[model samples]
Target: MGIKNRLTVMSFLQFFVWGAWLITVGNYWFGTKGWSGAEFGAVFSTLGIASIIMPALTGIIADRWINAEKLYGILHILSGLAIFYIPQVDNPTLFYWVIFLAMMFYMPTISLSNSVAYNILKNNNFDVVKVFPPIRVWGTIGFIAAMWMTNLSGNKASVNMFYISGFASLVLGIYSFTLPKCPAQKSVVKNASWTEKLGLDAFKLFGTYKMALFFIFSMFLGGALQLTNMYGDTYLSDFANTPKYADSFVSKYSTIIMSISQISETLFILAIPFFLKRFGIKQVMLISMLAWVLRFGLFAYGNPGDGLWMIIMSCVVYGMAFDFFNISGSLFIETTTDFRIRSSAQGLFMMMSNGFGAFFGGIFSGIVIDKFFTHDGVRDWHNIWLSFAGYALIIAIAFAVLFKHKHYAEDVATVTH
Candidate 1:
């Protein structure tokens, strides 16, 4: 296969492995298992927990000992086995631990996939920034395709999603071995310090006031990122119980409606260079924070009738809200951090945002909905969404006031792949 074909397959299966389960797992928990909000919250928290430690560890191994492609293949195979076992397990507690382990193996591969693609593309003398996004967009397409498959097959609420994921993962794992090898590079210093050896030296960035604030707010914004993923489709589907919306198009095709976010994401990713070049990271991120406010607030007032447009708009804005902070924030890290500790720095960024942010968001948001927002099993979804919107507003204001960024014209240089 040509490099492009290989990358297309890699990209497809990369997210296919995740898509087979991530979005619809809530359906399985709520619809099939009839589990409590708290239990489900705990289950999702595993992603955050795994994010805290796994990526850096795997990154260390890839850089110093194992070949990146081999490690990526092995991890995917192991994660596939974990997903296969998911169907057999019935206990929520056991399931949580098992999924946590699976996430530990899986989360690192996200970053590893980037590394694998980067190395291969660079080896072939391709422009990474330009070439990689189109290939990576296929990952988003893969995610949407998986969601369509799960919903259409009537497997969204069953353990069958895991089976589909497991099979795809197995194929991807075997295919990985055939790719160009990404052997580990020897360290320049044989007797590096423990911190340098493990890449823990990246933590020293915490001493810089501006970078510290950026990371801290990144955590808060990260909390908002998972909220839509956890509940957006389920929230829309909730209208199914109401007589007025029972037969609505959205109720029947919630996953497809949800996919507008991914479609929007592809467009936004393409536009990143223009926005970064024009606005700089600080202002761009501020726009992202405000965009989240619109994302949730529109959801608060939206329903299946006249309000459906608001919901769709919210999904549309999510592309900016997510890509602005995530991709832009990553680029910001790349620009600010030293080359030696860059990988570890990026891992730390993920740890704060996705790891800690998601853990707290899942548990707290669930508690708020169950305890304070629920009145007789039916949620006060409007108020819940409003509260989220309010949170976004506050975070945006705080970020604008506290973090000062000086925009350098040259800083906006477009990265060509």
Candidate 2:
């Protein structure tokens, strides 16, 4: 197979491993295992905990001690084993640790996969900027496909979803070894500080007023990012408990219904360049925060019946809520930071948004839902979603009032070109 096809397969299975279980796992936790929301929140926080330390540590290891592809493959294989074991654990606390181990192995590969792909693409004389996005979109397609498979196969709330994910992860692990080599570049400066060597230099951005505020908000908004992912499917599926909506399509196929969010993600990604050009970064991001409000507010009123359009609209708005802030935030870092620390700044962005954000979102949201939203073993999803909407609104207002930036047409034009 050609390199593009090989990378395409790589990309597809990479996300397929995640897609198989990420969304519907809430169903497995709440619906299948009958776990408490607080505990399950801790479960999702595993991603945050793992993201906090693993990616940077692994990056250092891959740069010094191992070939990127080899390390990537090993991590996947170990993660697959951990995922396979998830079905056997009956205790929630034990399951948290298992999933945390799995995430530790799985999360770093997201960045490593990009590194491997970029390396091979550049080696083959392809323009990574032009060629890679098309290949990467297949990852989303793969994710959507996995969600459909999990739902249609009636494994949305079953251990079988983990089996599907585990086996795919194993297959991807072995396949990674056969890809082109990405050898470590071990040429460190003779006098590099421990911090610089570890990529901790990006933390220096916290000293700057703008970058510090940007990161703080990144963490806050990051908390908002995973709320829907954590609950949307479970919320829809819970409609089954109601007599009128019990047999509805949304309840039966919540995963597929929720796949609309991913579809919306693809569309919104295409719209970012246009939006950024017209509104600039701050305005575009503010639009994103407002979109998150709409995303959750719509969900608060949506149902599987006549209000299904609200659910769908909420998913549609997700594209803007997610892409605008994330993509624009990355662009902001790229355009503004010094070249010496740019790569580290990018890593710090991921650390803030995905790492700390996922952690805070998972732990606190779970606690809040358990404490305030749950009653007599049932959840008030309407109120739950409304609370989330309120949280997003506060973040939007704070961002508008406190975060400052001027639109530079030339800078945005440079980025687009």
Candidate 3:
């Protein structure tokens, strides 16, 4: 295979490992294990906690001491082992830590994969800006493929899901060893301060009012993403409890249905350039916030019966809801930040959304659902989704009122892919 194809395979398996377990784990926790929502919340929080703690540290290691590809491989190997151990963890608290361990090893690899790809592509004379997006899209396809494998094999709510994830991760880890090398920058690391090495220098952005609000909202919006990931598949799978819908395709294949969101995501990424040119970043982001409202509201009303289109439509809108803000936010950072700290600023953006945002979203959503949305061990999924919709609406209104930015088509033209 050519280098691009090899990189494509790497990208594919990178997310394939995650998709095997991520959406379906909620089903396993809530259905097979019969765990409490609050505990499951803690379980999901592992992603957030890992996101917060691991990426920057791993970046430092990849920069100073270890080759990026080797570090990426090691992390995946460790993550695979951690995941393989999860089925043996019968205790919820132990499961939380085990998953946390897996996430700590796994989360950093997402960024590391990008770094590895960028390094190899640049070295091979590929235009990363033009070539990378298509390569990265394969990761989404891999995620969809893994979801289908789990659902079709009837392992969506079983320990076998972890086995699938673990096996793929190990394979990817091994494959990573054969990829082109991305050596550490031994000399540059020697000159940078500890704070710069840790990406803490981006904290200076918070002193500016606009960037501060942007980071704050990014964190909150990130939490909203976790809310859906935590429950979307579980909600569909639980339709089996209702005799009227138990035989529905959705109930039988919730992971496959939820995979539609990832599908939409890939399509929406293609549409962002047009949207950014026409609507500018703030409007595009506002559109994303509104799209989130629609995503949850549709889920609140749609059932497997005649409202199947609503469920499908919600999945379609997911592409817009997720991609719009993330891409636009990245553009905002790219266009605004000083060149010296731009990379660290981007890291800060991920930290706020995927790290702190996901952490709070997982913790609070679980507790709130247990207290207000459960009755006799049955969940009020309708009210649950409506509450999430309300949360998105509030965030949308607040963003409109508080955050300010002026749009210049020329500015975005240079910055956008």
Report RMSD (Å) for each prediction in the order shown.
2.0, 2.7, 2.6
lDDT of 3 at 320: 91
- The segments of candidate 2 whose C-alpha lies over 4 angstroms from its true place after superposition are 1-3, 63-65, 118-130, 181-185, 276-280, 327-346, 407-417
CA lDDT scores, all candidates in order:
0.83, 0.84, 0.85
Better of 1 and 2 by TM-score: 1
lDDT of 2 by residue, 1-417 (tens): 999999999989998999999999999998788888899899889888887888766765665668888998999999999999999999998999999999999987876776677668767887554566567767877888899999999899899999999999999999999999987665667799997676566677899998999988988898888888899999998999999998999988899999998888777766766777678888998999999999999999999878999999999999889878876786677567653454446556766777899999999999999899889988999999999999999999999999998887667544222
**Best model per lDDT:** 3
lDDT of 3 at 228: 82
lDDT of 1 by residue, 326-353 (tens): 8788767756766455556677788778
Among the numbered candidates, top TM-score falls to 1
Q: Could you tell me every candidate's TM-score relative to the true structure? A: 0.94, 0.90, 0.91
lDDT of 3 at 119: 68
Best of the two (2, 3) by TM-score: 3
